[model samples]
Target: MEDRSVRRQLSLLQTSFLLIYIYRNDSCRSTQFASTEGTTSARLPPVSKFGTVKVSGNSMLPAYRDGDSLFVSWVDGASALSAVGKSIIGKAVVIEREERPGIFLVKRVKNFQDGNYWVEGDGPGSTDSRTWGWVKPDEIIGVVLFRYKKAKPLVSE
Candidate 1:
């Protein structure tokens, strides 16, 4: 019957749309970043020295959003108090919550004074140094270098 034919066509269209959505939102896409440490090409540093982190909250909005992936370069907390860590000021960093052993947060380095780091988030509702006090040098995990934003769904409007 014609009704059955129309139903089949609609089902096929729906299936095609689903496939397109899945392809657009695929998370298994390549995550490799080429290394330029040894070459003089003046590109980004080696990907081997960086680690990826997925943002989970909106605390770092405007700069980073939830579900966004970040590439970070690891740091040595022991040397963070020295001049080596001074460069960390004004950069966004991943910090392991001092109060909560396993919790992590992304915040911008506000200041480095009195052997402590003052970090804050860009979002007004962010829970950063204002709520958690100063962040210790050893709490800093790494500095953010790049961000891979999640694909935004298309709106027909």
Candidate 2:
């Protein structure tokens, strides 16, 4: 069984029209997340909106600790992101190229060349685009809006 606490957001099922709109409009940035429903407290920020998400890995250290959830946004297109020159705001993307696959990577966008962008972790320990290579525009999932700090574990609990 999936642990409710450990498991994070669940995206909603997509309709053909929605997918069509995303492709046709070419503004397919936000991904509509399906809510679990019935659990108000568990309701996470809309996946489409630049909102907070829980971190489930340790690839990003120092800047992010294990189990430390954060907020990110799904921004697309190198041209649209040309103005962005700071750290990537919680842009966790999946690498699906022939070389990389099924990897959930989070970091900031440094430089954009051609159709790809350079991504890396803030900490030296982090292995980001430096290790993998250039990040294509389609690989980016979204930009992080914020992350709620994980609560310290109690000795008793």
Candidate 3:
């Protein structure tokens, strides 16, 4: 009886994990617009509009803390400047750090001038436009839609 109970619990746990994984992956896929070489326009047929990214630092502070996950609406470089010709000032955005390739950072859009953007963090210690100067449109990955906090695991005593 004890062995059977343990097996049932394990099976239940596995099923729970599988369901969560599927849901999470489904929510994470976002639309991506790839620009053609030498062209300032994005290719057609955009996929889903939403995506997820995890925060890794305190740069955003009160607005977004470390370990928080954000759901964003992706905006590709060519589309941001051409297709969506609206101002993004004061909006939180995910940007690919110019100095450190492959690393992404969350910052607020502070200024826009001559087709470039200046971003800053709410936290004073953040490394942003003050350190790296203006960010090109191509560096912006997505606009933050909402933040999701990680759920704490339940402890069974």
Candidate 4:
């Protein structure tokens, strides 16, 4: 766990459609001096499911922590990443890890390597895919779109 609010938030995210608000362009205020908010380039992939989870261990610290609520989105880009575009790190994913052959483990992708990915905690001393070894491409599911927690330095690069 998490608190009641986080649970409620997760329930809502699980049911509603969502989009990741990535910044693509910048806008400025005219006339009076003012600052425009960062613009978002939302080309959101279709959402199949959504939910929130409080990180339980340091395995994903710096990126996540115990009690941290994450807004996870399940999408269709499960079979491959080149098909999904961009790195899946910092994104919530439902990838298959040999740890649980039949069950789907949802976690952030973190980064990839020569067939292996380096996943760690945004918090201190968090273990991740790095601890578990390479995850097959067929395992990845989706990306995390939102989170509610204090930011911290990542334990792994």
C-alpha local distance difference test of each model: 0.65, 0.48, 0.67, 0.45
TM-score of 1: 0.62
Query: In model 2, how large is the Cα lDDT of residue 12?
Result: 20
For candidate 1, lDDT tens digit of each residue in 15-101? 666456445434433232211111111122223445666677677778877667786776666574465656778888877755765
Cα TM-score per model:
0.62, 0.49, 0.65, 0.47
| lDDT (tens digit, per residue) of candidate 2 on 1-157 | 4664233212122234334544543343333321111001222223354444444445556656555656455455454454563344345432223344333555766776665777776556566666778876666656655555433332331
Q: Tell me the lDDT of model 3 at 116.
A: 84
User: Runs in model 4 with CA error above 4 Å?
Assistant: 1-47, 89-94, 101-110, 113-116, 149-157
Expressed as tens digits, the lDDT of each residue in 1-157 for candidate 4 is 4796696666555433222221111121111100011111222233235544334444444555455566555454435565554466556554444554433344556666665555444444334454676666655544567665533322332
Clashing pairs in 1: none
For model 4, state the Cα shift of residue 116 in Å: 5.0
Could you give the candidate ranking by lDDT, starting with the highest?
Answer: 3, 1, 2, 4
Question: In model 2, what lDDT does residue 89 have?
Answer: 37
**Candidates 1 and 3, the one with greater lDDT:** 3
Worst 10 residues of 2 by lDDT: 34-43
Candidate 3, position 130, lDDT: 91
Model 2, position 144: C-alpha lDDT score: 55
Q: Against the true structure, whose TM-score is highest?
A: 3
